[model samples]
Target: MQCRLVVNGFLSSSKFSEIYAWLKAAFEKRGHDMTVCTNIELAFEKTAVTEPILFWDKDVTLAKGLEAMGLRLFNSSRAIEYCDNKALTYIALKDKVPMPTTIPAPMTYRNIGYTHTEFVKKAGDLLGYPFVIKECFGSFGQQVYLAKEPSQAMSIVKNTREPLVFQKFIAESQGKDIRINVVGGKAQAAMLRRNEKDFRANITIGGKMEKYTPSAEEINIAEYVCDILGLDFGGVDLLIGSSGPLVCEVNSNAHFKNIYDCTNINIADKIAEHIEKCMDI
Candidate 1:
């Protein structure tokens, strides 16, 4: 099958190159007509006739524009919309299985107010220190902060786009989180990221990763989370909380090589296989 794997950002970017190399080598080995390009430099006029396009982690705005121009996305446009928002995904799936806590932005300080702590300056008495303050729309470990006080949490909300969520800290979580790579509604690989010194659990930010096996419940939660969010393929972050497996976030265009090394699975190949399975060559 002819495939066009589109990626945002520069090819030299570590995150971009990591996935690109795997995809390039894998698809070429399979003899699929493949092309890769940055979002802005992509000349859709030429590619439209030769291949099927799959955009990586681009904002849905571009997808909408592409659709209007008669371009197609590997994942349906509607699914992309739902997967982009972490809060929405959490709200949608919280009832089905264990899910993270998130408080939306643009509210009074009193409604989502703060306190003081020596360990966590300007802390929020409610959410408490080490609680999470995530930007309404951020990915790749960016725009996520740990607030010990209400003031820090307030800053995160006041500085970012309206409607943010204050996630209650999972202290017993042991400064770690699990990310499951799922494709075609199946869990392919799992990695545990931990940084006891810091609050966040993303590998890019000084966190360590180790192979992990998800229990039946965690796997079920992984499948259910993505299925509910309408994700085609994504990295779902889960926490092994006291309750069970609690999903933290769903990354639509997840970076896979780091995960591949940790899990020893050729996720790029699986992605190609998935494409071949869903498409009529």
Candidate 2:
């Protein structure tokens, strides 16, 4: 199969570039032709939709445009959009999956910032203090925060000039979580991430990783989330709840280098195989 890998143009970090290179190599190993291109390249060029596009970036506009031109995308544009925004992800999976109680911050314009943060107090009343505040769009646990008091919560809300969400903080899962890599409706690999100094267990932020064998329930929840989100593949973060695993986040284009180091499982190979099976069908 002939394919193209679409990545973000603005992001030039080696972390992202390495993933693209590994994916390209995986596809080539399978005797499939794959080319890498940035969103900027495709945006300016009048390119024809000749082959399938493995969208590895979060540029939803370009993904949608390519879809409109009749090119098949591995994970559809709609799926990427839903996963790109934290509030949207919760809204999409609220009733279908088990997750922390989440409350979306009211919409506010960037020019006209929040005049009054009364909603933060209300959210505090519902979710209590020391809750989670996450920007709608972020990665690697950078935008996630913990507000220990109402004042801090209100301050964080007023300062952040973008869409965000309030979530109940699972103290039991603080500084630890599970990252499950799902492909083609299956949980292919998993890792336990723990941060000794921070609450966020993302490997990018000084978190430690070790191979993890997910429980049956955890795997089921992860796989079901991908199915509901219409994702061809994704990385599902699960917090260890008192009762069972709670869905923390679903990443449509999740970076897998850390998971590969932990589990010695190359998710790129799984993705390539899945795409080949899909194109065959």
Candidate 3:
């Protein structure tokens, strides 16, 4: 079998390179020929091929084009779009999965910014203090914030130009969260991320990781979330709320390097196998 691996050209980094190398090797080991292509490479192409695409980029336009060209993408363009924005992810899974009380921030034009503070106050009032504020489109937990007071929360909202969401912060889950990797409707590997010094438990933000065995319920929710979101493979971040597990976020193209370090699980291999099964290779 032969496949095209599509990624963003400008977003190249050491982490991305490493993951690409692993995935390429994994696919090759399974008797598959994987060719790495960037969005730029297909920018002017007016032809279509019969090979499947493993899209690793957030370039929705390019992904859609490829799909329309009769190519099957691993996660699909729709799934990637839904997971790219936190608010969209919340909306897509709110009814299908357990999640925090998430409210999309009121729309504000980038040029005008927040013209008033009333909406921010309203969000603060509803979510209460220590609420979670997250940029709709972000990664590595950098755009997530824990607003301790209404004033600070309002300030954070007023200063931002990007779309955001306000969520009920689960106090019990502070500094910790579980990341479950789901592939082909199955929970594959999971790890617990903890940051004693920060409320966010993202490994990129100095969080520690440990191999974790998820509960049956966690596994169910993780896989179900993927099924509903049309994700071929992803990482579901869940918070242990007082009542049960509440979804924190979902990653369409989830980074697996940290989880590999913790669990010694090469998710790339699982991904390759899943793709083979999916494509009937």
Candidate 4:
């Protein structure tokens, strides 16, 4: 099998570089010739799209271009776009999966910002204080915020100039969450993440991780999310709610190193094998 692992214009960080290395090695070990291609290297003049693509970037334009040339994208361009936007992810999986009450932030121009923030008041009224505010496109828990009071919530709204969301905060799941890696509509590896101080339980945000076995409900949520999103592989984040597991978010190109370190499970291997089967290698 010959394929190209497509990435963004930049590698972003060492974490992403490490993930690319692991994925490349995993496929190569399975007797496949994997070439790394950045979005910068894409050329429209090229023909012969014989090899499948393992797209690891969120550049929808590049992904779409590749697809237009008849190259198969592992998770598909639509899948990446759906998962890239937090509000869209909720909208797409609203009835399909259990999740916190989410309200998409009103549209705003980047220059003018949220000139009419009266909607913030409405969101505060509906979601209440201590609600979760997340920038629509963020990862590793960096753009997530907790507003403990209306003042704090309003302040967040006033400060943020990007698309965002107001969500019901699950207190029981504060500082704790579950990450389940799903490949080919199946849950492959799971981990529990907890932080004593922060509300976000992302390992990148100082959370502790431990290997975990997901319940049937949890597994269903994880697999269903991937299946519905048309993802070949994904990392599903779940909040342990009082009633059941509520989805926190989904990562199309989730970094598997943390899960590997915690569970000694190489999700890259699972992904490689799944891709092989998908492309019929």
In terms of lDDT, the poorest run of 10 residues in model 3 is: 41-50
Please give the CA lDDT of all the candidate structures. Answer: 0.71, 0.92, 0.91, 0.90
> Of 2 and 4, which scores higher on lDDT?
2
Question: What would the per-residue lDDT of candidate 4 be over residues 128-190, giving only the tens digit for each residue?
Answer: 878999999999899999988877887888897999999999999999999999999999999
The clash number for model 2 is 0
CA displacement after TM-score superposition, residue 36 of candidate 4 (Å) = 0.4
TM-scores for candidates 1 onward, in order? 0.84, 0.98, 0.97, 0.97
lDDT of 1: 0.71
lDDT of 3 by residue, 1-281 (tens): 99888878898689899988898999999889999988887887626456888999999998888888888999899999999999999999987889999999888899999778788788878888889999999999999999999889888988899999999999999999999999889998999999999999999899999989999999999999999899999999999999999999999999889989999888899999999998887
- Is 2 or 4 the stronger prediction by TM-score? 2
1-281, model 2: which lDDT tens digit per residue?
88999999999999999999999999999988998888999997626547999999888999998988888898899999999999999999998999999999999999988878998999999998799999999899999999999889988988889899999999999999999999999999999999999999998899999889999999999999999999999999999989889999999999988988888999999999999898883
Better of 1 and 2 by lDDT: 2
Q: Alpha-carbon error at 149 in model 4, in Å?
A: 1.5
lDDT by residue for model 1 (222-257), tens: 887778877777888987688777788888778887
Please tell me which model should have the higher lDDT, number 2 or number 3.
2
TM-score of 3: 0.97
> Among these predicted structures, which one has the highest TM-score?
2
Q: Quick one: how many clashes does candidate 4 have?
A: 0
- Evaluate model 2: give its lDDT: 0.92
